[model samples]
Target: MLTLAAGASAPSVATQLVGSGLIGLREGLETGIVVMILVAFLVKSDRRDALKWVWLGVAAAVAMVAIIFVAIHFGTSTVTGLAAELISGLASLVAVVIVTAMILWMRKAAASISGHLRAGLSKALAVGPFAVASMAFFAVGREGVETALLLVGYAENTAGSIWPLVGLLLGIAVAAALTVALYFGAVRINFAAFFRYTGVFLVVVAAGILAYGVRALQIAGWLPGGSNLAFDVSAHFDTSTWYGTVLQGIFNFRPDPTVLQVVAWAVYLVVVLTLFLRPLPAKPGPERAPLPEPSNIPAS
Candidate 1:
């Protein structure tokens, strides 16, 4: 049993667990969707022969991500004290940026991703197998790296060690199963609505992460005024309480946060939430195969 001193509390284990799970679910679903789209396009086009190459590319991407994850794990373990804090702060900031971009890009791209992928498939088919394989690699590889970055950031901040990893693994497993069902037409989801809600949730999560990044920087002495907190609610609200765990789990909530942390959190939430909730722009989708290039249609 770990002991906490006066006005000192370690991170909640449950919070880390659920937070990591959400990240895993979101990231896993995106990766699954990309692969599903590629596979579906090939099948519909009667290009079943190219499926092997696609799978190969996906495998290669997975292997690359696995290697990177392992390397980071070992490397972070060796880092300690101020160095670890500095690295974590920077990494968390990067993760927030990537996640924010992903959420916004998905908002715009979700509507046209299928069409764009199909068009890309058509072009890839015109090229060689290498191009097809490379296309799949790039598509899947991107999501894989993004997923890894999210996990890495979470891992860096977690004090409960393996609890976060367990949640992430469970979420990913659930996501994989969901993807398979969706691809086989056993399940149908309103992806637009799904993305909208999840995007909002992720924006909130990113704000929390960004604030935590500032906290980390302050702890590392990379930023001044670590002790200059805006308020100290710890006297009245104990983080060991049930509600505290809930808040901390969902939003990384702290009782007493530095002025910089509060400012960063507030500005991020207001700016990003407003931008994310704005209406999506209208646009033409992937040119629609040029209307079959009508010249000679068998001259019936």
Candidate 2:
């Protein structure tokens, strides 16, 4: 086990399991929903011939994401010491930015996404098989790339433990089952509420990651104030304990955080939370089509 400064223990294998699971669930569902939409559209519009192409695109996207994930997760293993720390810090920061944009964009786009997707698919059909496949590839690929990057960031926090990967796979499995259920009209969900709640959870997670990133940079000597203590509750709160593991795993909480970490965490949480929770500008309800959109999936 790698010894951290000031009596802070290295994270255990299970430390980040829950956080990774949630990320997988959210990202997997988004990817699944895109596939469901495209498939349903093709089926309903009598474009069954294009179904194979759509599947091809989805398969390609998944394969691409897997390759990217493997390359990234293992690539950093080659580096040691400060270089690794610097990479981890930068990667975590990038994940935070991407996840933040995803959260905010989903808030606005969720309402209109179905119509836009259908429209895009329609145009792609006119273009030919390659376009149709490319459309699905890009649509799902975006979510896949985001998921890969986020998972890597989470894994870095846990010192490359296998538990984070296990948690993510479990979450994706659940998401897949849920997506299948919804696709077959066996379940109904208020997607708006779902996204909103998950978005909030992710924002908190991202804030934690951002703080972790700042600490990493500081450790790597890329930033000053590594020893500038904001507060050290190491005596009172042991990170190796069960509760401590949970806190560190879920929120990246450190008993001895630097001034910069605390400031980054606080500012990000307050600003992003406020923006996320604020009422959105009024707009017409999303357009409807013959096939039910994700928001309108039927239960029973």
Candidate 3:
């Protein structure tokens, strides 16, 4: 949607499906893993009753996100021009910040996250099902909200909401099916590889969004020097041309980019990618030697 909104052509259904499928696959796998971990923990502790709480939390989170989406949608309808631009720009910036934080958190604490979750769940279960549900709600809610915000931005920009939304729904449905399969040990995929690649893709996508947001601000006349055309490729390739349209849809590519937009895009890609690809810090060595039983927590 971000791509389309930035003057890119509308994508075919196949392309939307593919893109949404990838997103769904990644997100679904993460959620699946979390649920699996909870189930496993419950089984180990003989606390099957707590599973209900997890479901409650998931439902609550979904509802909360839905409410937010509706509010933003209706609110945007009443606002025009600069107000709409500011809203979208601010939302994009918030998404960028949240995504950045999430990436950093994953990098710094991936190894210990499972352990922390297990500890929290153990405590929550003792407090009853409500506590369990709250934990689950928050666990899933964070991912859900982020996905919703990003999708909304995409929808607004591309004017291709119907297809993308359909694609997103389909992707999620497939993911849910796969989750069930995973529970039965009927499917397996290297999650580490999946996250690594998707993380890189998301970084690029987010950078494009950041650039798009800046352009929006420029359009609203909030940002300076937007009137000056940095360069023009309209002579060689019109925006309506097949190649131009495709480039626009895929990467939010503009033949004529402003100085600020170009600089923002370049700097974002270089800085974010460099930081994202850097080697993570090593975990500290254990103080004690071997234990009688092995730990369930996996090493990063």
TM-scores vs. true structure, each candidate: 0.86, 0.90, 0.84
lDDT of 3 by residue, 209-230 (tens): 7777778788877788687767
Error of 3 at 112 (Å): 2.7
Q: Residue by residue across 144-261, what tens digits does model 1's lDDT show?
A: 7777776776556445267667778888898898888887667766666666777787788788878888999999999987999999988888667778866776677788999999
lDDT of each: 0.75, 0.81, 0.66
Candidate 1 local lDDT, residue 44? 65
* Residue 148 Cα positional deviation in candidate 1, in Å, after optimal superposition: 1.5
* lDDT of prediction 1: 0.75
Estimate candidate 3's RMSD in Å: 4.7
- Considering TM-score, where higher is better, how would the candidates rank from best to worst? 2, 1, 3
Report the lDDT tens digits of candidate 2 across residue range 1-300.
122224334455455657788888998887888888888788778889999999899989999999988877666677889998888898889989987887888777776677778889999999999999999999999888888887777666665466777778888998999899998878876777778898898899889889988999999998899999999998999667889888888788889999999999999999999989888777655442232455453221
Q: lDDT of model 2 at residue 285?
A: 53
Best by TM-score: 2
- Residue 273 miss distance in model 1 (angstroms): 1.4
